[model samples]
Target: MISILFAVLTALSNGTASVLQRRAAADAPEEDALRLSLLRDLLRKGIWIGGIAMSAVAAVCQAVALATGPIAIVQPIFVIELPFTLLLGGLLFHGSFPRSVWLAVAAVAGGLSLFLLAAAPSGGDASVTTGFWPEALLVTGLFLAALLAVGLRVRGNARAATLGLAAACGYALTAATMKDAMARLDHGVGAFFTGWQLYATAAIGAGSLFVLQNALQAGSLAASQPMLSIGDALISTCYGVTLFSESLRTGWWLVPQLAALALVLAGCIGLSRSPLADGLAPRPDDRPRTDVPAAV
Candidate 1:
């Protein structure tokens, strides 16, 4: 129960942070998007600072949740972050929250509950084999590099969605690595530093932030949020099963799980179309202009 509570709190913190961070990043001076210049500019914004603080809180809460619960259980719970973002973003922007969005939120809640209860994920090892480490690192690194390359080549909503998915992949890999490193805390602080997962988590986390900033800068929240939410859920589930050796109910139970996935997807789609999501995008006048003045 404590783990569940912490996961929920983590979702709240992360959701609110997304809105704050994007607001600051969107207002930053035009530059190479997601470059150090944009980051330096956003660092001066109070809202961005508050967003970073919230993200830190979320990370702490997530670590606590992971320590106490299976990765499958803790990570899937983060799907609620999208709905929470819609709620908080609406409140922050004074936008009217729609009934359909609430219905979608309720569907997500019910679907997650039904899916988790049916799946009953269990069994995980605290330590990964040495050989597995190289494989895991290589696969994740290749995937992220491909995603970044493709995302950087796009523009507008497509760019946002692609970069958001890349961020999601980074976040999923980070969570898996973080779980591995945190498990070493049982041995002592020295053990944690000795583990390569700790370093990988830091590197991936920094990359995720860079990708996320570009995602936000590329387009509206609607373009990024659904991709980020859905991609994280899918990748994290695979990581939990593969890396942690966690098991979910198979055979007959797969049907309900599939249905639950459909429900979650539907909810995410609905919320992405909400007024609150629209508000998250910069106003037309606020967008960076590329038009040069007419030659005098």
Candidate 2:
């Protein structure tokens, strides 16, 4: 229960952090795509600073959650962060939350709970074997490099989704490495720092921040968010199983797991189409357009 509570708190903080940062990013000066220069202007924004603070809180909650529960349990719960973002956006922007949006939120919430309960994931070793490090690094690095290449060539929504996938890869790997580092703390406080996992976590986490900023800057949240949520959940599940030796129920329970996936997919799709998703979209009156041809 403690772990579950912390996971929920983490989702809330993360969701809010995402919204705040993206809002600030929208107003920041334009820079070359995917360049470090983009963050320079945002550093001056109070909202962005608040967002970073919230992310710090989320990280603390995430560590506690991973320490107490399986990754399968903690990561899937994060899927709800999108819905939480919508809810917070409504409050912050004084916007309406439609019935369909609420329904999608309910679907996500129910599906996540059902999947976790049915899957009953368990059994993970705290410490990883040294031999696995090279293999893990090689595989994850190749995958991320490929994804990033595809993302950088695209424009608009496609670019957002692709970059978001890259970000998801970075974040999932960070979580896996962080879990291993946490496990090392059992030996002694020094053991945590002595391991390469801690260093790897920081590196990957920083990269994820850059990827996520670029994704948000490239286009609407609608385009990037679904890919971010779903990709993270999928990749994190694989990581939990392969890296930590976590197990999920098999056989007949596969039905519920599949059903849960469907529900999550549907909910994400619906939420992505919601008016709330376009909170950042320019209103017709807000910006005069010279791009569109004048009516006869």
**What are the candidates' C-alpha RMSDs?**
4.1, 5.0
| TM-scores, each model vs. reference | 0.93, 0.93
lDDT score of residue 157 within candidate 2: 88
Per residue, candidate 2 scores C-alpha lDDT tens digits across 1-296 of 78789989988998998888777766544455788778887787788899999989998998888888888778888899888887786666555789999999988988888899889888887666778878988998999899889987788889889998899888888888888889898999998889888998888898898899888888887788778877887898888888888999999999999898888888888888888888644345533367899666
Model 2 stretches astray by more than 4 angstroms? 29-31, 282-296
For model 2, which pairs clash? none
Supply candidate 2's per-residue lDDT for 186. Answer: 90
- Candidate 1 runs further than 4 Å off: 284-296
Q: What is the lDDT of residue 107 in candidate 2?
A: 87
State the lDDT of candidate 1 residue by residue for 48-165, as single tens digits. Answer: 9999999999999988888888788888888999988878878776667779989989988888888898898888876565667788778988988898898777788898899999
Evaluate model 2: give its TM-score. 0.93
